[model samples]
Target: MKKPLIDMKNIRKTYANGSLEVEVLKGISLTIDQGEFVSIIGSSGSGKSTLMNIIGCLDTCSLGEYLLDSKDINSYTEKELAIVRNEKIGFIFQKFNLLAKLNCYENVELPLIYRCMETQERRERVLKSLEMVGLSDRLKHRPSEMSGGQQQRVAIARALACAPPLILADEPTGNLDSKSSNEIMNILIDLNRKGVTLVLITHDNDIAELAHRIIRISDGEITSSIDCKRGM
Candidate 1:
């Protein structure tokens, strides 16, 4: 049997504001396998973002066991975690998060630059990723020069350039029009079909329905998880 790609056990996160204490996660446990497309849906302040952060390795749980690819991530040092984040996972945000000054190709190549990849290899990977998103012709355009949908595509291309096994997207389609949203979702679906595991965080039911499985959260706990074979 193929082991689960992500195994999270009894995870917990808490924050304090003076005398007030907020518990964001109440012992959450989840397991996601390779090639799976999952959506995490929840209301505001329901800990969905916190969970996303933990899953993306951007933050650690106050208590719990998190294993990525069968290796315990809790034991990794900050530097090690940085490497894991860079090489194993890709992230997309609601705001597109592209550098304003850099052109499409340069923005996509940023990750490779951080990893100190050779210039030629970086260029090849960037171009391939851009091509995958059908944005090869827009490589020279800056963020301000593109529409919201185009900017998001560039962000997706940036995420893909590293060839990470896992992609964590937070409200990826929130800023786009219905047509653009569908386009981005189709891109994500195609990527998953090609064997990239994806975990999407969103409040929109329509967007969540695109995944093969859905996990609903409320009050910092998983309320239910349903398998939607229809692939909405």
Candidate 2:
């Protein structure tokens, strides 16, 4: 069997006030294999966001182990974590985070800049990513010139431009209409079919149903994990 892409064991996170401490994650553990599409469903303040941040390497767990491709991340320094995030994970937010001034192609090209890829290589990747999302013709359009759905597509393209092994989307369809949400979900499913591992956080069951696996959280703990392939 292929090795898991992500292996998190007994993960825990806590925040502190002056005289009180709050535990956000209560020993959550999970393993996600390569090319798998998984959704985390929970209500607000359910620790879903904290878990996503940990998975994306944006934050660290206060305890337990997190291994990405067999490399333990708890020991990594801030700079190392930054490198890992840039090279191994792609992030999409509820708000389509795009630069207002840069055109679509330029926005997609931004991640590659940090990697210091040559100009030609960056251009090729940007174009290919844009084409993958059916936005090849909008390469020159700025964020303000596009609709919300188009902007989210641009965000996806930007995420893909890095060619990262894992994509972490936090409420990706939250800002779109039902039609646009369907379109975005279809694109995500297509990407998963093409072998990009996806981990998304959503409150909508309809959105979660699209994933092959669903993990539900409540009160900062994983309450259930359901494999949905039979239903699919």
Candidate 3:
């Protein structure tokens, strides 16, 4: 059988300041298969955000093993971790972290530039990703020139530009209104259907319910996990 896309075991995260130590993730063991849509749901002050950071390779776990794509991520050096982040995981943020000065196409092409892809290849990828997000016509427009939903779509395109196997979204709809949030969620659903493994962090149960599986966390521990019908 093929290995699971994500295989985390007893993952822990702790922060220390002076004489105080706070444990954020207390032994999280979860596995997600390729092409699955999983949502991590938690309230403010919970460890979902920290967990997302760990999964996205932006942070390391304090203890236990994390296997992303069957490789031990905790064993990697800082530079290797950075490379893993760029090559294996795609990130979408709540704030739509786009460059205000760059156009949509440019923003989408930034990852390819890091890979040193050829100009023609980057152009093809950028245009294809934007088209997937339904932003083909807005390629030349800047983030400041678009609405919140459009900006989020551009962010999605940027994430897709790398064609990573795993997509990690942290409160991707937090800054959007209801209509915009649904639109963004629909786009994510479409991507998952197309074989991208999706992991989303959200505080809203309604939003979490949209995913095929929901993992609930509370007080730095996994409280429950449920499989949904995925009415997509």
Please, what are the lDDT tens digits per residue for candidate 3 over residues 130-207? 998899999899998999999999999988989999999998999999999999999999999999999999888898
The prediction achieving the highest lDDT against the true structure is 1
lDDT of the candidates, in the order given = 0.94, 0.93, 0.92
The weakest ten consecutive residues by lDDT in model 1 span 223-232
Question: Where does candidate 3 have its weakest 10-residue lDDT segment?
Answer: 223-232
Model 1, 1-232: lDDT tens per residue? 7569999999999999899988999999999999899999999988999999999899999999999999999999999999999999999999999999999999999999999999999999999999999899998999999999999999999999999999999999999999999999999999999989999998899788878899999999999999886454
lDDT score at residue 178, model 3, on the 0-100 scale: 97
What would you estimate as the lDDT of candidate 1? 0.94
| Candidate 2 residue pairs that clash | none
Give per-model CA RMSD: 1.2, 1.1, 1.4
Query: Using Cα atoms with residue i matched to residue i, what is each candidate's TM-score against the true structure?
Result: 0.97, 0.97, 0.96
Residue 218 accuracy (lDDT) in model 2: 96
> What's the residue-level lDDT of 231 in candidate 1?
54
